[model samples]
Target chain A: MSDAALRSPLHAEHVALGATLVPFAGWEMPVRYTGDIAEHTAVRTAAGLFDLSHMGEISVRGDGAAAFLDHALVGRMSAVGLWGAKYTMMCTPEGGVIDDLIVYRRDWDHFIIVANAANKDTVIAELGARLAGFDAALEDVSAEIALIAVQGPRAEEIVARMCVRGDDDIHAMRYYTAANILLTGDIHAFAARTGYTGEDGFELFVAADQAAAVWELALAEGAGDGLVPCGLSARDSLRLEAGMPLYGQELTRDTTPFDAGLGRIVAFGTAANPRGAFVGRDALLRAKAAGPARVLVGLVGDGRRAARTGYAVTDDAGTQVGTVTSGAPSPTLGRPIAMAYVPPALSAPGTVVGIDVRGRREDMTVVALPFYSRAS
Target chain B: MATVPEELAYSAEHEWVSGDTDAGVVVTVGITEHAAEALGDIVYVEAPRVGDTVVAGEVCGELESTKAVSELYSPVSGVVTAVNEALERAPEAINADAYGDGWIFKVELSESATDLLDAEAYAASVA
Candidate 1:
């Protein structure tokens, strides 16, 4: 696609910082601003700002919003109160995941769902079909919303400084919760205390026209704490280190929540659960009982030779067991780590496996999830 | 952008060849600054082990960034005399200083060094 057809609010800022621009999810995104390691280190050590406007935002509103969402999504949306957000999945009838999303409960009658950019249309279509008989309205508001993530240890302080109104209250917002904030002058932003980087942070949702101003304000406020404008490259590495799943990588249409090891989010029986039925519930319940054939697990290489996506995962005897979904030479861990699906027998921690890197089988070991975790 | 050192020979693949070319023709090879710029960031460098044999245009190492993985091809046939042990600890040196401290491997070239490009030729090739 042409450069004009794909743009972000931070396009000029990225160019000013000499970022390597690349197209992702139909938007021109910065792959790396200054350097990947530098940006990655900034997020791990201090703080980092990310322009995440490419993520899709869909609004579900009206009387039956709660019931409609509970019926259409896998997570218990009825349990989420105002200002609460729950990570959930929309699935196909065959138990395959349509898209993993975050459902934010604005109120009893209004909800906002954030989905992967590439799966926006599919998710909207599925939700629309499921809400046919319900008294609800679904609208795709992706183009009008701009999302920015400020993540790391110093996130709260940095964000507070940017917003001149009652900055102290920002720290009281619990993780996975959100609130509307009145920033300096007349700028109003919806800030959610949620992030994929496994860091203490907030994701700000603002009008598309206000994105550049808010981005500049945050950067200026965070300058002292070594906050950098991180791009997609650092964002991927940070999320990988946190063991969070990506859409095309850890999630796909053929992959169920059970296979992805997300059963905890699937609420089978609850008061707020839909009455009649939902798609994929039966198949998912069956998989939950019998256990999935393959399970997603973390893999750590012996050295810096990363096991990239599509690399064959094998047992010690070189038997092909599975394939790597997402892999990278971790900037934080200083080694190659990957997420892959392996046979249930070989999913245990410390189980030795091999990753075929460029036709050569490199030794690896199955490890526990979340290669890196923030201090609570 | 960092300038390509005039004293070093370069390859079409953006690897720089430096070091002594007189006594036994020992040359150290690393990626150019321009290549590092394109790579965005350097996360890992899988350098060939000491004493390994490599052929020209063959991949002797691998370089991985957050976004992609690329093969570090050998610019000249040689026996790997030494690998950058520091890269195992801090691979970002390839991004910070692609020409100096980020030198990947040292090799004893098997043939004369006349096949490599000069600084101007390498720049022109990339352009």
Candidate 2:
């Protein structure tokens, strides 16, 4: 490993478990423990534990926090109920996405913004600059915090077994809601029913020093339930299968929320309870009026030749229409699935399109977003 | 650590060639276990057509893992005599057993390649 590579608090644990560590977004994180396929299948079938300490967290709080976030983020932050989390985006003045983040309304005045690891510094700087007129205070709490996630059908069962304190009725907790939970030894942690794997999972935010204990406890409790320690590779395939857009891949500075079919995040013209004003509101409103030229869609087909990132998307006649952003062989679906941006006409489900896999164009049928969704 | 058989001659590109060079060298070519392990899971394997002439250290086909795609380079100049047809339907065989059942193709070596690495040297390079 490079000397400058940042190590997660659970780095030693990953090494002890014989994990394959890879440099990801400047952090020396585990990419796989046993293998990608096994770990991916474990999450889908049973349970999987993840060391996501590398992901960035920023705490924003003050009297003007709600008003400040509304103007800064694309979503209506003030509208989110207390202890609720909402998927939102922060965009530039021209409406180009700066980063896609989840805002957790912790209280009446405090909120926590979770950004992608790679975009942490950028998001912090952007938030600092945007806090000029507002009285909100922003703090980058990434290094001080460690995130551990337990995802799958057995997630709640395993998590409940390890909890020595806090919210006894955690099984009844609603999705997108967070509660502070204490584990054995009075380990203070915040548990949220949120995850990236498109499963019923919980993300636990704990102190950096307590990461290993939480990880080991979850793994020990989940051992009989077939909970395996998963890595970024499996997490990626899981998210891709769920049709979630990655920060650097599907969302970029050149791509707007509307272009990515995420215009619902932009708060505009909702007179019922309008979010007074926000950055990029005018541009987003204009984009809404003119409709996006291209939109994101899900593509599925047989065969192992996956249409990887940057692969060209073409019509049946071989004319280029768009490009693929993320793709992989779906472990659950037993075929190759991908997400791409294509013309609105070709974005409809069942529309046949050709994916230029290398030089050869392979036939793929456009499908609805989210190749797999767990039963509610 | 991935296994590197002593009976096979290795290449810098992580290809293992198994055959004798005394007579007309008939060699079976496959990617090393190290390459397969690094690739995570093999989802696609593109093999050269039978009877296709390939140059030493040149690209012959490609291997697609679940994460990324990599070019497969021929170790020595030869004509591909046989290609592994079974890999088309089951590419994960390479990840399961990279050397034995996963041999990519068979080649009739035209001439002895001087740049071929022995097992010790090849292992050292990867190590």
- For TM-score, the strongest prediction is 2
- Stretches off by above 4 angstroms in model 2 are none
- Model 2: per-residue lDDT, tens digit, A198-288? 9999999999998988988998999999999999989999999988999989999988999988888787745676566688788888888
Standalone chain B TM-score for every prediction? 0.92, 0.96
The local lDDT score (0 to 100) that residue A13 gets in candidate 1 is 78
Query: Which runs of model 1 end up more than 4 angstroms from their true locations?
Result: A166-168, A270-275, B1-9, B18-26, B49-51, B80-90, B112-127
TM-score of each: 0.92, 0.96
Each candidate's number of clashing pairs is 0, 0
Question: Candidate 2, what DockQ?
Answer: 0.65
Task: Give the alpha-carbon lDDT of every model.
Answer: 0.87, 0.90
Native contacts recovered by model 1? 0.80
Tens digit per residue, CA lDDT, model 1, B1-127: 5578889988888899996554368889999998888876777788899999887788888888877888899987878999989998788888888888899999898866556789998888876
True-vs-predicted CA distance for residue A110, candidate 1, Å: 1.5
